[model samples]
Target chain A: MLDSRVLRVFREVFDDEQLAVSDTTSARDVPDWDSLAQVKLVIALEQEFDVRFSTTEIGTWACVGDLKRALRSKLGAA
Target chain B: MSAPAEIRVSLDWGGGEPMIVRWLVADRAPVKRGQAICEIEASKATADIVSPADGILVVVIPDGDVRDQEVVGHIHAVGEALPLSAAAVERGPEPDVEGGTHVPRSLRKAAEIRTLEEGRRGSLPSTVMQQLVVGDLVDRLRDGGASLTALVILAVARALRKHRAFNASASDTGVLLHDAVRIGVALDVEPHGLRVPIVTDADTKTVAEIAGDLQILLYKYMTKTLEPDEIRGATFTLTDLSSFGVAWSVPLLVGRQAAILGLGMIRGADPRDTMLTFSLTFDHRVASGREAALFLSDVRKRISEHMVSNDSGA
Candidate 1:
């Protein structure tokens, strides 16, 4: 359920329904997801989940899985 | 009903012939302008291709190397009878646009909006015209392996160097005078649109040097390989219509720059002595017509002197 919601955020940020977030997916997977897009994504995620991400935590995210883990930690659940 | 708009590609510098990685929207899906219609993978990285107009996306060259100025697809208006094949939708092979005069509706609308915006900004434009004998100058430029356009740019740059008032834009605080002479050269980038690629510190470059710089810019322009910074920030503009058979024209000032110079076609009563008309249009609020006249006269003097000069063309 968290994965689906996170996918929605990716789709909205990139303006592409074709965007697919898998365990292996990274910034290279989504075209035009540069530093600016990353900032936008972070903002959208914070608004979506009502959670703030630290700059240190954001840099640690290498893929969707990392992002989900961080989100889970903040939510206090798997 | 509005016609279908061609989605031409403008690849960023260093990203030529990028691979069409994937289509973000399905074929014939409704798309809004500014929407990411597809994703392209360049040599260095990837970029999203945004929709140029609001309509249904029709993909052509669906997958492969799509270079600059190449039509990858079209956006047909809603409820319009869509052409089943790419051949039916395309006006022709777009690279050969010199022979085709197809102005996509979206481009036309953009031009209209731009003209309206310029009007809204408002410029008190005034013009001063002069005719110069350009036969020898043309020969000199050819000998140097440069172009008449380069020579004209060189002259305008020199004149701007002497006349600081001509190289300024009006601001609420006061007239904003530029430190360097960056000249904007207008070239007809048909099918795509008119582009004014700038040559920075133009007054400092020799005629041949400017020619070499122009050649690189021309190549970049033709290949749609121009970087974003290649086409901005001009203190003055030089628009050449000499080849188009235009005898005379008063060019409108671009943005807030104080002046724009127009070069007309080479023509004369005696075949031995051909003359080019140079017209300077200035922002009257920032510069007087007398100053504009002096600036044009200076350009004519510089061009005429260079024509008969003994030194090998600069």
Candidate 2:
């Protein structure tokens, strides 16, 4: 299950106010999600979740569901 | 009706991954005479597409469509029938308009200077002229609350009046008082390479009118159509790097021009977290270094006042 807080972070980062976390959402599905915007999103996620993402780990996140899984593991480890 | 020009919105990543359109500006929107049309992620760097003309943006791609390369968008060309595809949209070798080219900086600067000279010859093509006119107007409006090109020119005249040194020129007959002063505005070819196109007798126009003229002038530089009278008569010059993140630059004096002013990028700490740095250079013989510094200080004061007044109005 996706953490509601993490989903909220996504909505705020993309400024969609209407985004939902689902299994198929990738970078392309978001309009304002450019590379620079992605950097900002990552920064926000780290601060909100109190987790550090490795460059390799960040690269592994291709979809919202994928990012959720990574966040879960990081939160569990912490 | 005849066929509208077919503009494709490309999305494929060559390997079949659809690319997303991260639009910076709106569709079918009339873009700033010189601003980027949109930003696209290419293989090497983020590419900012520019508008070739000012017109209603006819949006072909509705923002979220994912496609391959060669996708066309609505063009500025106005006609009953759209232009037939004569060339691939994204296939041209990128003009050295953005990324700093591998060409030596000195060489690049020289080329840009030459290009400016060409623009002064009144040979600047029509397209460039339009862009320069519009861009300059937009810039003035952004800096000042209301942009009547004439009013802006008058303000410049007032600013020059305050600086007596720029008002005088040197010849074999010692120094002479001139009725007018020329001001050159620097245009960035690639948001990096700089070119100066003079606005003839800029001191005479009102600030508002100058704003309108400056927009036309920027278009001339971009389209390569500046007239000789416009580019050749400047007595002083102003270079603005504020749009880019440039902190400052110390420039060499152009021939016969008494002074050159460089406006650095504006930044500051919160309230808003940005800062600004400034540089000014002038002919040591005509205006002492100290005097030049005073002129900058005065201009800074004026700009600060302008900014404050604008904020209040908004």
Q: lDDT per residue, candidate 2, A3-76, as tens digits? A: 77877888887778878767677655664553334545666788898887764454345677787778888889
Against the true structure, what is every candidate's RMSD?
21.5, 21.2
lDDT of 1 by residue, B20-132 (tens): 78889888899999999988877667888899889899887566655456667899999998866643443454484467566654533444344324523667777889887
- lDDT by residue for model 2 (B51-99), tens: 5455544544333323244343555644434333322221245676877
TM-score of chain B of each: 0.64, 0.48
Interface DockQ of each model = 0.01, 0.02
Where in model 2 is the C-alpha error above 4 Å?
A1-78, B1-156, B171-173, B191-194, B200-207, B269-275, B308-314
Native-to-model Cα distance after best TM-score fit, residue B45 in candidate 2, in Å:
44
TM-score winner: 1
lDDT assessment of candidate 2: 0.52
Q: How far is B73's C-alpha from truth in model 1 (Å)?
A: 29
